[model samples]
Target: MNINIKFPDNSVHQFPRNTTPLQIAENISSGLARDVITASVNGKLVDVNYPIQEDARIELFKFDSLPGKEIYWHSTAHLMAQAVKDLFPEVQVTIGPAIENGFYYDFDKDVPFTDEDLEKIETRMKELARENLEYKRREVSREEAIEIFRKMKENYKIEILEEIPPGEKISIYSQGNFTDLCRGPHIIHTGKIKAIKLLKISGAYWRGDARNKMLQRIYGISFPTSKELNQYLVDLEEAKKRDHRKIGKDLDLYSISDDIGAGLVLWHPNGAMIRNVVERYWIDKHLEADYKIVYTPHIGKSELWDTSGHLGFYRESMYSPMLVDEQEYYVKPMNCPFHIAIYQSQKRSYKELPLKYAEMGTVYRYEHSGALHGLMRVRGFTVDDAHIICTPEQLYDEVEKTLVFSLDMLRDFGFRDFKIYLATMPEKAVGERQNWDQATESLREALHKNKIAYEMDEGGGAFYGPKIDIKVKDSLNRLWQCSTIQFDFNLPQRFNMEYIAPDNQPHRPFMVHRALLGSVERFFGTLIEYHSGNFPLWLCPIQVQILPISENYEDYARSVYAEIRQHGIRAEIDLKSEKIGYKIREAEVRKIPYMFIVGQKEKEEGTVSVRRHTAGDLGSFLLQDIVKRLKEEILTKK
Candidate 1:
């Protein structure tokens, strides 16, 4: 029988029913077949060797594609696992999956993998890759699979097989002497992984459950060329230098103490000052934009959460309830419920439509202790949250305005490059289909009207509604998810939010949840890394450090500092009994933007020597002139 194959460009070609994707590629061009790693056969990812038995849509993937890279990395992971098994015969593999940047495999082993072990494993992986072993897949009956694993004494595989329903096909992939249970669309052979690097090793709980046994996880990445791998290594080193935790400590910005508990940040005076400045700027902009700022409590009653459906769908991330006056009160994981409560507090009118409520609300959520990072993943953080309550007619305009505002704010914060994602409803989403469709269409229309290009994330939205997620590119070219504007069709219907219409009837108001900066702590962390501790003059905690050459010049330095402070520049005098060079070095180490040096010549001439942190001396200038320049920069937020 002949089958029709549709290409991505909508071109169709006739082929035999048993023709594989590889054969189709080869018929087109040998180069395409050589580069093809995987394919989407009728929207289902499958190996190129899989037969096409019917007319279907086919999209072949090369290493340049995301799915192709995933397949390459996953196949490299299996190769690494094979090497580990070769080196350690007793280790049992549980699961190995591809992540955002790389892949990791968890092993059930008594002995933990060390740095030396990774080197050996990488060596072995290279040796195995040179052999160009083929990854062959076989489908077996559940009983046969269980018997195979049982005979091999791979208890983890046996346990996994028990969960599989009877009469279902269990796929097993084998390469050389290594075999694993997987649903794979891997690369044809291991030789494609030309450059490999085992990044690191860490302990991870089996299945991410605290109650489960801890397993050793080895993370690794691969590239098709040595040049790409080398460039990646360079980027990795730069990332370490820009790591927020290290920069935070070096700058004395924030600290996380064991006594204070993990995932909780204690911002020192410097960090607090930066945060205060950011908050003031945020508030001023919000007020200018006609946002009604409000404060909400950290906890809400269980009944309130029940009505909001947070207890039903989002309870896992929430803390356990606390008893207050015989009633259970839980710490809020989101500010939406409180905002809803405010909306429901009194009768609203359509004339008051598009009521923008903004808040820097702090909320607490439970994160796994192991999953917690420096400031990115925290238990408690403040969100620059806002809710826009509007009528159906106003939804599109409101969303568009929010999108423009969000992009403007991000650009102001030095994020010029962005990738926006329009996430559609998930399978488990709430609200009626009509509501979801309307909300999704509004978001799509906003993006289209604004001429903003965005990628669609199919079935990747929140349970409530569709959303627009903005990811900003940092200095290192790394993407960080920051802004989100989500429509909530479930909340208004659940709370029965009503506003008086022109016809004297109650109508539901559309609720939109927006967080342009996401969590303040996370944003601050990103800011630190983006600038590599060299914050702009406006955001720097210590804008100017006055360094006196000797104790005799302290008075002049103090006067210079006072004068700078008068111009609203954050300035401090270095009074420590240290040499001039030492003080200058210390100022540079602290990442102070400017340094005002005072000495006999400067004091006598009524001028201060100006030195930038990284840019040497900037000649001498009158204290007033220096202050004027600094004020101009600060006012301009340069």
Candidate 2:
């Protein structure tokens, strides 16, 4: 018997029945056979050794491809399981899967894994990889799976098997003496895992349920070659160097203390100064763009969430309600509800169709302890949120204008490269079919008209609407999600919002919720990493630091700094008794944009030696000249 295997290019190949994809690859080319790690059959990833029984479309995945990475990392996870079994034979492996960053394996070990154990396991993993043992996949009956794991005394595997649906064919992957309950698409052999390292160990609840047993999760990353591994390690080092948590502390920008509790950021004076400048600029730009600024309360009645349908879907991220005068109140997790309430406050007319309301609204959400990382993921943060209420005919133009506004603002913040994604209706959305179609089409047309290239995510939107998310690329080539525009039809109908038409008929209005700097805290953190804390003169908390030659020149330095400060420059006087060189170094370490050295010779002539933060020896200049140059740099938007 023969089977037809369709290639991605629509070409079909006749292969003998039960022929494996690996065998077919070998027939085509030995190079491809060696490189192919996995195969996608009819859009589902499967092991290369899996038998082909029916006609199906196939795509061979290499190490660089997404499916290839999945298989490689999945194979590496098997390697990790092997090492863990060897090191702790008493431990039971429940599950291991490949994640975005790498692979993680959950273990029911008697002892909690520590950094030392991770190092030991990593060393053993290298030894196992050296063996180059073949990874074999086998189909087993549910009863057989239970018996095998039972004989091995792996109760975790038994528990997982019991929950599997009846009559389901169970699969077991065995590499060396370690076997796991998994549906695998692993590499052909352990030799394919050339470069591997265990990164971290953390405690995770079984199946992510808080009530389940705590399992030790060992995270690791792997590559096919040493060069790629080395590059990854170098990138990790660079990320650490650019970590905002470290830079924020070194510069005294912000701090979080145990007394203040977790996920609550206490912005110091310096950080507040930078926030003030950014907020002021943001307000001016929105006003110039014909946006009306509105203020919303930090907390609202819990019933409001019910009307917005957030309570039904987004309750996990929301704070618990507080009883207030026989009513429940919630600290807002999103500003959309209040903005919608304002739109419903008055009877709207078609002449006011495209009413834009913008706000720097602060919101609070209960981010998990494990998920919170410095300012990037926080419990309390302000959103540069806005909403546009328009008629259906105005949908395309409104979306286009919002995209233009967001992209231009991001460019002004020095983010030039961006990737856009149009996320369609979700599986759990609540909107009429026609409304969903119209909103999705309008968003697509807006992107197309603006000449912005974007990829479509089949079902990545909220439970109420479709959306477009803009991910900005930073200096290190990492993408940070910064902007989002969502088209919501459910919210307007849920809140019973409407606007009067030209012909005196009331009808539902389309709602567009958008945020350029999605979360102010996260955006600030990304900016810190993108520029490595060397913010532009305008955004820098301390734009200039005045370093005097000694204590004798403190008065002169204060005068120079005062004059600059009077001109709206953020200048600080270093009046410490430290040497001039020491003060200059401190200024550089603080990432101050400019340093002005005021000494006896410079004080008499009303001149100061200017030194840039990164570029040294900017030489002597009149006080007024330096001020003019600094002001120009600040005034220039981009």
lDDT by candidate, in order shown: 0.90, 0.88
Give candidate 2's error at residue 423 in angstroms: 4.2
Worst 10 residues of 1 by lDDT: 472-481
Clashing residue pairs for model 2: none
Per-residue lDDT, model 2, residue 480, is 66
- Expressed as tens digits, the lDDT of each residue in 7-40 for candidate 2 is 8889898999988889989988999999999998
The regions of model 1 sitting more than 4 angstroms off are 1-75, 88-117, 129-195, 202-217, 222-231, 426-429, 456-460, 472-480
Per-residue error for 62 in candidate 1, Å, reads 11
Clashes of 1: 0
Best by TM-score: 2
Off by over 4 Å in 2: 1-72, 90-101, 108-112, 134-175, 178-195, 204-215, 223-235, 302-306, 310-330, 368-370, 416-434, 448-460, 471-481, 604-606
